[model samples]
Target: MNMCFVTHKVRKGDGQGRVNYEVILEALRQGHYVYIIASELSDELAQHERVIWKKIAVEGWPTELLRNQIFAIRASLWLTILRNRIDLTIVNGFTAYVRSDINCIHFVHSAWLRSKYHPIVERKSLSSFYQYIYTRLNRSLERMAMKRTRTIVAVSEQVKHELKGDAHIEGNRIAVIRNGVDLEEFYPRHVDRRELHLSEQQLYAMFAGDLRSSRKNLDTVLKALVSVPEIHLLVLGNTKGSLYPQMAADLGLGERVQFLGYRTDMATWMSAADLFVFPSRYEPFALVLLEAMAVGLPVVASSNCGAVELLTNKAAIIINDPDDSDALADALLRCAADRRQLKQMGEEARRLACQHSWSAMAAQYLQLIQETALHKAVPLPES
Candidate 1:
C-alpha cells in the first residue's frame, strides 16, 4: 500500500508529531511505501530508506495561523496532483483542505471554544483577539474537510462526541482510537531524589505541559498546592515567560512549586514524583497522563481529560470540577494521607499503561486504513 501522511511536523518532541512519526515507522515496518508530507522532519526519519519525505517550506510566517494556512494550501495542491497515484491520504485535522481518505483529528476546535478557560472567552489581549479569529477560521476549514473525508479518526471518545454533537459529523464516519504510550521508554522505575535535586522526605507531584496557557489550569494546581502543604509540584515544561512563577509566589507556594522547565528525561522526572496532577480545563487526550501511569505514578486528573476514560477509581482519582481548587486539593490530600492506597493505585496505573503500546496503536490504524480502502466510497460534499 502507498500510504501518505500529511502533518505540520514529523518529529519526536510534540505529541501529534510523535504520533505521525510512530505510525509512519509502523507502516514501513509492515512493508508499505510511506510518504510523509510535512514542514519539518527529524533527522532520523529523513534518513530512513523506506520513507519518502516531501518537504513544504512555510517558515517565517508572521503568525502561526498564516503558516498553517500556507502549509494546508500547499499540501492540498500536492494531494490533488497525487490523488490518483496514492492508495490513501491521512490528513491532520487542523490543516486539512484536500479530499482525503482519512482525517485524523487530534483536537476538536469547537470543543476547545466551549471549554471553561477558552481564550476567546477569558482573554482580553490583542493577541487573544487574533487567536479567536484564527480559531473560527480553522473551525470553518475543519467542517469542509470533514465533509470531504471518507473516514475520520478521533483520538478519543470525547473528541468523537464533539465531532458528532458540535461539528455535526456522522457517528458512523468517525472512529475512536485513543493515543498510546511508549511502554519501554516510560515504564516503572526508581530514581534517587538527590539526582533530581529533590528532597528525599518531601512528596513530589508532577505536572507536564505548556504553562503559559490558562487551559492547562496550572493556577488551579497552584491553589491546590496551597491547601496541600506537604506535596511539592515538579513542573516539567517551558516557563520562561509564564505568569505561573508569579502566581506561585503570590499563593506563598514559592518553595513548594519547582519549575524544572522542558526536559527530555520525562521518564526520570515521573520516577522522581509520588503522583501526577493534571488539572487541565480541556484536553482531547493527555499523553503525559499515560506516560506518568506507565512510570507507576497515581494520577489525580480532571474529568475533562479524555485519558480519564481509560482510568478507574482504583487507578486514579478524577475531579468532577476542574475550576474547583478545593476538589483538586482534597483529592491530592487524600492521596498524600494514604500511602498504601497511593502505592496500590500506582501499581494499577502501571498495569493499565502496559496494556497500551505505540505498536498496538499503529496496528489498529493500519487495520482501519485497509478496511477503509476496501469499503465503498462515499460521495464528497460539493466544494
Candidate 2:
C-alpha cells in the first residue's frame, strides 16, 4: 500500500519527526510506498528510500496564526499533486487538508492549546481571552480537518478525551495507539556501572528529557532528591532554558545532582544508572518512559502520564500525585534500598517494552487504515 505522512517538520532533533521517520521506514520495510509532506526537512534524511519530502512555507507566522491559517487545504492539495495512489494519509501534527479517497489517520501528540509545555503558549498561561478565541477557531479548523479524516490516533486516552470534549470528536472516531521505543537501540547491555564514577553498592537515579515548563515537575523531582541524599540523581537531556541547574544549586545538591544536558548517547546514560525517574505532572505519552523501560531500568513515574497505562504488574511504580515530594522521595528510596525488587521490576519493564514493538504497532496501524478505507461511508465526527 502507498502511505503519505504529513508532519510539522522532519529532523533528528525533533522527537515527533524521528518517530514518524521510524514508522515510515518500518512501513517501507514491509514493502509499502511511503511519502512525507512536512514544513521543514533535514539533509540527513533526504537520502532515505521510497520517501518523497515536500517542504512547505511555515516560518514567520506565530503558532496561533499558523493554527488558524487558511492555507491548510491548499497545502494538502499541493501534497496530493506530488503523489500517486495514496492508500493512507497519516497526519502527524495537524491536517493539511482532507482527502475523500485517502484513509487519513490523525495522530494527536498532546493538547497543543491546553498544554503548558507547548512552545507557543508559555507554561500554563493561556489567558481566558486567548483560550476563548483560539479554542473556538482551532476547534473549528481541527474539526473540519478531522471530520474528513478516516481515524484519529491518540497517543494517550487523556488526549482522546480532550479531543472529544474540546473538539466534539466522538470516542469511536479515536483510537489509542501509544508510541513505542526502539528496543535494539535502548536495551540493557552490561556496562561497568563504576565507569561513570560511583560505588557499586550506592544507589543512582536518572532523569532524561527536557526539564522545562511547569508540567515536567523538575522542581518536585529536585525537592525529592534532597529528601533522599543517599540516592544520587543525574539529569540528562537538554536544559536549553530550564531553571533546573539553579534549583539544584539552591537545594545544595550541587555535585550530587549532575546536569548532563542534551545527551545524544541516552542508551549509555540509561545503562549506567540503576533507576529512571520521571515525575511529570502531565504527559500524553513520555516517549522516554518507554525508552527507560526498554533499557531494563526500574521506572518511577507519575500516574498522570499516558504511558503509565502500558505498565502492568511489577513493571513500574506509579506515583499518583506528582506534587507530593514525599511520595516521589519514598519511591526513589524504595528502589535504592532494595536491589532484588529493583532488578525484578527492571526485568519486568524490559519484558513489557519488548512486547510493544514498532512492527506490532505498524500492523495495527495498517489494519486501522484498511478498515477506515473500507468503511468510508460512515460519519467521521461522532455525535
Candidate 3:
C-alpha cells in the first residue's frame, strides 16, 4: 500500500512528529511507500530511503487569513499528490486538507476547540477577534474533516468523549489506539540519581515536558511541593518559560524545585525519581506516564490525563482535581513513607508497561488500515 501522512512539520525532539516518523518507518518496513506532506521537513527525515518529504507553506503566517490562504494552496497541492500516488492518506492532526479514496482518519490528540479547553487556551493565547474566528472556523473545518474521514482514532477514551460533541463522530468509527512506550529504551536501568547531582536521601518527584504549556499546569506541581517539605521536584525538560524557575520562585518553592532541561536519558531521570507527577489540564495520551511506569516509578497524575484509564489498582494514584495541591502532596507523601509498598507498586506498574509496546501500537495501525481498505469496497449512500 502507498501510505501518505500529513502533519504540521517535521522537527527534532517533537513527540508527535517523532511518533509519526517511527510509524512511517514501520509502514515502510512493511513495504509500504510512505510519503509525508508537511509544512516543513527536517533533513533527518528527508534522508530516509523509503520516505518522501513534501513541503508546503501553512505555518509562520501572521494572520488567520494568511494562514488559511497558505492552507488552501497547500491543500490543493496535497490533494493533487494524493490523487495520483497515494493508496491511503493518514491525516495526523490537520485532516481538513483534501478528499481521498479513503476517508482520512482524524487522530485527535486532545479535545481542543471546546468550551472548557478552548476557553482556557483562547484566553491564554489569542486576541478576541482571532478567538472568535478561530473557534468558529476551526470547529467547522474539523467537523467537515470528521465527516469525510474513513475512520477516527482517538488517542484515549477521555479524548474520545472530549471530541464526541465537537467532532460529532460515531463511536464505532473512532477507534482508541493509544500512544505507546518504547519498552527497550524506557525499562528499568542502573542510572544513579546522585550522578544527576541529587543526594541519595532526598526524595525526588519528576515533571517532564514543556513547562510553557498551561495545559500542563506545572504551577500546581510547584505549589504542591511547598506542602511536602522533604520532597524535591526534578523537573526534566526545558524550563525557559512562565512555569519554570520563575514560577518556582513566585510560589516560594525556591531550591526545592530543580529544572533539568532536555536530558538525553529520560529513563535515567525516571529511575532517579521516587514519584512521577503529571498535573496536565488535558492530554490525549500521557506517554510520559508509561515511560515512568516502565522504569518502575509510581505515578501521581491528574485525572484529566488520558493514560490514567490504563492504570491498574496497584500502580497509579489519580488526583481528580488539578487545583488540589493537598491531594498531590498527600499522594507523594504516601509513596515516600512506604518503601515496600512503593516498590511493590512500581513492580506492578512495570508489569503493566511490559504489556504495551510500540510494536503492538504499530500492529493496531496496520490492522486499522487494512480494515479501512476492506470497508472501502462497499458503496455508501449520499448525504
Candidate 4:
C-alpha cells in the first residue's frame, strides 16, 4: 500500500513527532511505500528507499502562526500532485488542508479555546490576543479537516469527545489510539541524585512543563507545595521567561521548591522522585506523564489531562480541578504521608506503562490503517 504521513516532524526522541516516527516504521516494516510531507523528517526515513519525502520549507516565516498557515498551504498543494498515487493518507490534525483517510487528532484547538484556563480567556495582554487568533485559526481549519476525513484517530478519549462536540462529528467515525512511551529509555532506574544536583536525602515530588504558561498550572503547584511542607518540588523547564520561580518565592515556598531549569535527563529525574505532580489546566495527552509512570513513579494529575484517563485509581491520584490548590496539596500530601502506598502506586504505574510501549502503539496504528484502507472514504456530512 502507498501511504502518506503528514506532520511537522517524524523522529524518535520525544513528543507527538515520535508517535508518527513509530507508525511510519511499522508501515515500512510491513513493506509499504511511505510518502512523508512535512517541514522536517528523520534522516532514516528520508534515506529509506521506500519512503518519498516532500519537505515543505517554512523556515522563513516570521511567526509560528504564519509558519503553520504556509505549511498547510504548501502541503495541500503537494497532496494534489500525489493524490492519484496515494492509497491512504494519514494526517496529523490540520497539518494540511487536503481531505484525509486517517486524521490523527493530537490536540483540539477548539476545546482549548473554549476552556476558561486558556491564556486568551485568562489574560488580557497583546501576546494573549495573538494566541487567541492562532487558536481560532487552527480550530476552524481543524474542523474542516476533521469533518472531511473518513477515519479520525484520536490520541485520547478526551480528544474524541471534543471532536464529537466541537466539530459535531459522529462518534462512530472516530477511533481512540492512545500515544505510547519509550520504555527502555525511561523505566525503573537508579540515577545518582548527587550527580544530578538534586538533594540526596530530600523527599521531593517532580513537576515538568512550560513554566511560563499558566496552562501548566505551576502556580497552583507552588501554592499546593506551601501546604505540604514535608515534600519539595523539583521544577523542570526553562526559567528564562518563566515566572514560576518568582511565584514560588512569593508564595513562601522558596525552601520547598527547587527550580531546575530544563534538563535532557527527564527519565532519570522521574525515577528519582517519590511521585510526579502535573495538574495541567488542559492537555490533549502528555507524554511526560507516561514517561514518568514508565520510570515507576506514581502521578498526581488533574482530570483535564488525557493521560489520566489511561491510568487506574491505584496508579495515580487524580484531582478534579487543576486550579484548586487544596486538592493538589491534598494529593501531594497523600504521597508524603504514606511511602508504602506511594511505592505500591509506583509499581502499579510501572505495570500499566508496560502495556503501552511505543511498539504497541505503532502496531495499533498499522492495524487501523490497514483496516481503514479496506473501506471507501465516507466523510461526515457538515452539521
Best by lDDT: 4
Better by lDDT, candidate 4 or 3 = 4
Clashing pairs in 4: none
Clash pairs, candidate 1, are: none
Give the per-residue lDDT of model 3 (tens digit) for 1-383: 87777776555356566556567757877888778877766776688787877777765788865676576568657767566777777775454456443333323423455536544444753554566566566666666666656677777787677667556677877788777688888887776666778888787888997776666878778877887887888887776655468878888888888888889878878888877889787776778888899888888898888888878769988988887888988887787788789888888899988887777877787888878777876654342
Per-residue lDDT value at 249 in model 2: 95
Q: Model 2 over residues 139-183: C-alpha lDDT tens digits?
A: 566666677776777777767877777667778768777676777
Order of models, best lDDT first: 4, 1, 3, 2
TM-score of 3: 0.88
- Candidate 3, which segments miss by more than 4 Å at Cα? 10-12, 40-45, 57-60, 63-72, 100-110, 115-136, 380-383
Candidate 1 regions exceeding 4 Å error are 376-383
In the order shown, what is each candidate's alpha-carbon RMSD?
1.3, 3.8, 3.0, 1.6
What is the C-alpha local distance difference test score of candidate 2?
0.73
- In order, the Cα lDDT scores of the candidates are 0.88, 0.73, 0.73, 0.89
Best by TM-score: 1
Candidate 1 per-residue lDDT over residues 257-358, each given as its tens digit:
999999999999899999999978999999999999999999999999999988999999999899899999999999999888999999999999887898
Candidate 3 lDDT (Cα, 0 to 1): 0.73
Question: What lDDT score is found at residue 378 in candidate 2?
Answer: 68
Weakest ten-residue segment in model 3 by summed lDDT: 101-110
C-alpha lDDT (0 to 100) for residue 274 of candidate 2: 88
Model 4 per-residue lDDT tens digits across residues 268-371: 78877989999999998998899999999999999999999879989999999898999888888888888999999999999998999999999999999989
